[model samples]
Target chain A: MDAVRPVFYVSDGTGITAETIGHSLLTQFSGSRFQTDRLPFVDTPDRARDAANRIRAAGEAARTRPIVVTSCVDGSLTALVAESGALMLDVFAPFIEPLERELGEARQQRVGQAHGIVDFDTYHRRINAMNYALTHDDGISMNYDEADLILVGVSRAGKTPTCVYLALHHGIRAANYPLTPDDLEEERLPAKLRQHRNKLFGLTIDPIRLHQIRQERRANSRYAQLDTCKREVAQAEAMLRREGIEMLSTTHASIEEISSRVLEHLGINREMY
Target chain B: MDAVRPVFYVSDGTGITAETIGHSLLTQFSGSRFQTDRLPFVDTPDRARDAANRIRAAGEAARTRPIVVTSCVDGSLTALVAESGALMLDVFAPFIEPLERELGEARQQRVGQAHGIVDFDTYHRRINAMNYALTHDDGISMNYDEADLILVGVSRAGKTPTCVYLALHHGIRAANYPLTPDDLEEERLPAKLRQHRNKLFGLTIDPIRLHQIRQERRANSRYAQLDTCKREVAQAEAMLRREGIEMLSTTHASIEEISSRVLEHLGINREMY
Candidate 1:
């Protein structure tokens, strides 16, 4: 069994930024197991001290120094965490000084600004894009005119989640349309989709994976059969190639990967959120 | 106007993780302007050299060392990036050595494992949660039995997006139901929601903000009126208080913040994705 180590994500705010960066880095090490704790809203000096004590306790209990990944912007709070005798990786400390020098501006050292809702315009744009994605999901609404990208795929080919991710993360108005059996039987893109073919991006997956996914949704059904999935995927791939649309396989790609590929293939520049 | 500094997010894979961490760090410096470029799939030494050249060019043009935040796990690739003559903050490099020593094991040094589809169970859970959120959005489906959480809020109070975020990021099965005018007028919890009161959470927002959001959705409608928004918000707050359910205001909260608060308040531990 892999040894378990205590991993702490500490932040003066919600700890999400720390958690995101920490988790991504941790995933690279497949040898060990991590027992994680998130300490959020540790803004005050008292809270910072308390978090440090907790880290010390965790290290003592595990008989190994706990790893702390922190995004605390306050200098004093970050120093307090560093004194906990753990291996501390400060996400902000390494970059802030250089940024200050490069920009010729002092750091604000404001708590929660990194993940807060200070920018209402960007927040609203993300919300609006999400609403757009929901309303236009599965071709329920024909509003492709407003979409920055329209994702098309067979059922369970990862269209909906990718659209939601694009909207939520990049504020991209993404609409997803599922290619139905009827459309696949004809081996042609639907009329409404053809008109917006310029913005069309296709997602394909292995038939076996699609079969397993469908089985989970509806067991012992014709739709969950391997043969059905194979036929549908074949037709979808042909349609994507025939229409000269960029296609990606979701069989081993994360939604983040799919969204990135879609954006890169479309040559869309993402607005900073 | 703030002078723009060139910023680069480089990674061995999609660059989304690097961009996420880099963007969060950069948000701390509100005084400076940034022109960002993302270079993904820089897995090989040759690609790393090319990426370094681009960074050097950006730095030369901007008359400042371009800031490069990278998540490259390969040693040679990271070394090549550090030689770019840019201010590089390697997200993975700073922690990997300590983590390796702590675990008493060597890293596999694999590229793109951090954001890949290697874990099918986790990937499926996220997809399942997303589908659940979509099906149960706005009380469209009353199958709250399987919901880990059910969010109740007025229309445009950011219930849908928050639920989707929780589902996508944490693999939490969240369902959101909109509070209608009729329920608010009655000043009572709906019959269907009464049994699941323990799992219910309320979302409220400032009437002015609600009005602005509604105006964008439907201009010149009674639903977008300030008076109407005020009445609905007041009623919603009172109803939440009467029902003894915890509530959070979404007026100035991001989806990440809202989800974190909801999970924290409900004593829910998120399954790390």
Candidate 2:
């Protein structure tokens, strides 16, 4: 068994930024197994000490120094955390001075949360996009006219998760319409979907993969049968190709990859939250 | 007028990690306005040059030096991107040496993607949690028995977004049920919820905020009226208190903050992806 190492993300805020960057770094070092935890809202010196103690205890228990990645802006809090028996990676340490020089101003004081809700408009855009996704999910509402991108494919082609990711992460209004057998039987796109041809992005998966996914949902059903899966996927691909919709095979792709391709194909440039 | 500064998160991979940490750092520079864009998948020399030109062009167009935060692993790619007229913040540059010394090994080769799909198990948890969130959204299904957390709250008090965030980020199966007028007036936890009180979390919002949200859905209706909002919020809070359920005010809280509180309260120590 690989050695188990303890890692902590200590942040004065949600610690999400620390964890995200730390995870990326950890991916680079793949030899040892890591058990990770986060000490969030560690703004005050008291909380910082508490976090340090936890890190120290984790190191002691594991018999290896814990690695703590922090995003705290306060120097004193960071200093306190540095005392822990750990390799501390400060997310903001290198960028601060250069940024201060570039902007010609000292960093502003914050109430200690990382996500900057610069305006209610920015916040509302995320929530509104989420609402649109949920309301138009599974073709419950065919408001394709308002959708920024429409995902079209057979059932379980990884549409809903991609829609949710796009909405929550990029503030993009994404709606998904599943292609049933009835729709797949015909060559042309659904009238509503044809209207939004520019917005359509199709997702296809390996029939074997789709079969495995469906098998878990319903055992031995026609939907889970390999023959039915192959037929539906073939028809779906043909229809998508005939209609000139951009298609991607989601068999081995993560939602991040699929969502990225959808946005790139649609020319939708949005910041990922 | 506030001058617009161009910001780029250029990466050999998704650039999501760069963008997230960069946003936190940007929060400190509150005086300047920033327009951010991401150039992902710059793994090759030609792609790196293209990204560099885009960064240089954005700076020229905006009449300001662009600020670039890159999470590139390839030294050559990083060097190419650095030649752009921008303040380059290399995300991994600060910690690489220290990490190498501590880990006693060089970083592994990656396929230019930040997300480390170490195992399909991690991937499945995220998708499974997402399906649970959708199936159980807005009291659509009463599978509280399988839920890791169940959010009980008034509609528009920010339950759905929190559930989605928890599932997507932490792989926690969170389901939400909206407390309607009838449910709030009963003064006891619903029979279904009572059985799983440990998993129940209540969300309440200010009536003014609730009224504003509801008004957008149905203008000038009884549900959107301020009086109805006040009464419903009051009754919901009272019922939560009577049932000994923990409640939170979602009026000013972001989904990140609320999700953190819920996990902390519930002692769910899952890593954030």
Candidate 3:
């Protein structure tokens, strides 16, 4: 932990895939500290050599072998990066061999398409969904006809971030309807949302977490009080239970977790673009 | 090509890591088509068996061996999935041994952290950046002191979506300034943006694509006219060039590609949260 190891993600494209895989792998070694770098778009041999040189320089500076994760489809690029005397891990290579054996066809020497614009329709849909998420956020729009999912929760209960995540990541038209004080008092599904009940997903947080989150927005106010939080959470849970809406707590969960569960429950298995 | 192969992404956590790797691999085999499914949170042995059953059922339905990509760190869960007579690809297992060798310590058998809220600060930063992006989008706020990056472009030239992507994906406080006709004619960045010149990045789009995008918003108006698009884009490009601001064309690039390039240009080495 004292000597931070240098890590590099080298790729022919954006290197995002390489970085994501590297980050996930690093998490398992919690005791180790790593200083990471990204050398993206190393398509040409010159760029690949430069990436290798950078890795070697980092190695000389750190006085240890750098760990390199390469997601390059072209084998030559990965080989060049590995020639820098680093512990190179080809994230896609191990899978490619097995995939070839299964399919009985060789994988093509193509660049990774993790972040490219291969599908214009998908691109537009993401942008459109983002626009939809913005306009329909926080009960601003009662029109839930086009929303793929409608997130219902109390104020400061972590609805907006999840909505944004759903739209931006999954291309889902996610509108959030905050269960206002009046709605909670009614103890019934909002009339407009009742029709779109199939699209409704409820989110709740622990009262303490909710209070803390709200306190950040409005300090020392009734809205941020623990009592108010507990009451609203209890009411929201009761209302959701009565309405037969499946829900999850976002207190310990990430936005990705909440959105993934929502998609799973709804049986939306669309590929993330 | 005639038959759509069935593919499954099984993981102890959200299965996002497995799915992401699978998706990128699938892109390499353009000649093959696939029907993909995600089985997230298969932590328990029972859940793992259920996931395996699902994979086997899909194989039976397709009359072809299914491809299973597993990101489970625990050996037991992955073993259960592999027993279903599918070609199982353990995404994490192959890397663990190498990472262990490099660190001179064993990797933990914990779940992947690709989608979990392991870092509270990082999670909150993402949510806060999202809020900031929303509040500061489309010239909504002139404040730039706090912005990590400011995106300026003509209307519908893909600023808002890019900003949202930056916020939601990279936890970047990205604000967009739509270069209006007035600003284009003046041949200078808006006065408010001059102070934050180093933070400024420009986005441009092909005039025809811009025309098409605008037509969807307000059909048959001057705003959607090809001439208007051409003039605005040309002027915006020239002005950005004259102001010594780096720019990229979003016409053919995905939002992820554009955002990655911007972060690279700005030298922001933030790990995507």
Candidate 4:
């Protein structure tokens, strides 16, 4: 029986979490003596069939008993379990029964929607807006045209982490463009953003704080100087007023509040905790 | 105002999240600038008082508008807000009212109980069991006396992970001892564990899978050979019976299941999830 082996099944979409958890679990049984294999993302029937065949073949070759553990959030989980022909220990199975009982006929359509409630149209729209924000570092033409809301700030004002956090956690499509020296020099909105002036929102902070953050990366560089930070912030704020950009001082707010305030200003739903 | 600075407050515990949120909010201003300072881990009354004094001193020295964004999870959060004497944004403040309304006193107490509960008697018993298991590696006098429960198996039987996981996550002390050729030669419990045998638990697996896991760590070593694994497993089980030790095959079990079964054997509280 020592010649027998074991096989593992991983069928979740984005198999990363499943693989990590499975590895952690298996590492605990060093003395148990088992072999493991992973079959991930079997979303289609043919893929499920292939996985089943592989598991069966591995079992047939085993000299002792066989065990298969599987994880998937989709209905394909049920399909993979049926095909594996080994004892299955399903982690997310308990939630399925309660969901069916609660949703009734709508449960068929609600399969993956337990984790996400927003429609796909809204999801894609937000993703596109965020994509725009990531690419356009300075507020320009697309800032007024596509962004549901625009984030304006001096350099290193934390626009990226906030934008990414909103996108990942709350499905908010947030774009941020920095207010730079040239923009402040002109003291006017960029030509592309002139039409949608009302959609622009600006963030300002204590220059000293901005200086400290800059110093961490550049260490005594011109950009990290306290006097330079003070001057640039003053210029950016004056230019925002001259260009008719509405703004807020980030000196006293939280990310949740800031993101929600932007959403509130734009009349969009705020979904963060 | 240009010469005036801003202050930033950063927390030690949940400050990372607070700073991200605070920065997002600050980016919205089109005009004006300030300074920032970080205040971490002011959860206690004394720390809050110290933070208040520091903020007061910084504000007195600054010429610009002073803003403070804070995040803390204790009653001292409110105390700090009252004492800061600046334009304050308390990030975690919003959570308290909502959680209080949802959980009420009973549920809050229960949550506290879960975190604070430590059965000292059980803890000592488990630690002794682990120490004994480390030395005996088989059912015997010391093993039985020390262990509230004993795990036995061939090499790589996963005793360490299971035992450690129990201790770390659930505060359930566990000790696992391996069965080796020396134990089987005697056809009895190891000399140290000969007295307290009832607490013994044994684990086995499909010998082939055991060989595969062993081969990864020690390729071509006799210990990784299928025949050797099978022989050791058989001998271990035979010795368990000869010495009246109990055993389980871990070839197809998940950690959750293994943990649950162990709890069942020990009459301990099982994890509901």
Best candidate according to DockQ: 3
Score residue B45 of candidate 2 by CA lDDT: 96
TM-score of 1: 0.94
Clashes of each: 0, 0, 0, 58
Q: How well is each residue in B1-273 modelled by candidate 2, as lDDT tens digits?
A: 756999998877667888888988898999889999888778899999998998999899988899999998888898998889799999988988888898887887574546623345766788899889988987868878889999998888889999999998889999999988878778777788888889988899999988988898899999999999999899999999888888988877777878988897888999876
lDDT tens digits, residues A1-273, model 3? 357899998888888788877888998888888999888888888988998998999989998889998898888878888889999899898888888878877888877577776566887888888888888986967678888889999987778888877887788999999998899999999888889999999999899988887888899999999999999999999999999999899887887888889999988877877
For model 4 the local lDDT of residue A231 reads 87
**All candidates' lDDT scores?**
0.86, 0.86, 0.86, 0.54
Please report the TM-score between candidate 3 and the true structure. 0.97
Off by over 4 Å in 4: A1-113, A116-123, A139-143, A169-173, A242-244, A270-273, B1-273
List-wise, what DockQ does each model earn? 0.62, 0.61, 0.72, 0.01
Error of 1 at B33 (Å): 1.2
Rank by TM-score, descending? 3, 2, 1, 4
Ranking by DockQ: 3, 1, 2, 4
C-alpha TM-score for every candidate: 0.94, 0.96, 0.97, 0.33
CAPRI grade, predicted model 3: medium
Q: Output the better candidate (1/4) by TM-score.
A: 1
Error (Å) of candidate 3 at residue A6 is 0.9
Better of 2 and 3 by DockQ: 3
| Model 4, span A1-273: residue lDDT tens | 245356464553323233333333333333355576655545567767776777777777874444554445555555655676665544334333432332231223222222222333443443344445445544554545655666777886756545644554345556777777776677776665666566677778779877876786599999899998998899888878777666766554444345545554565643321
- Candidate 2: TM-score of chain A is 0.95
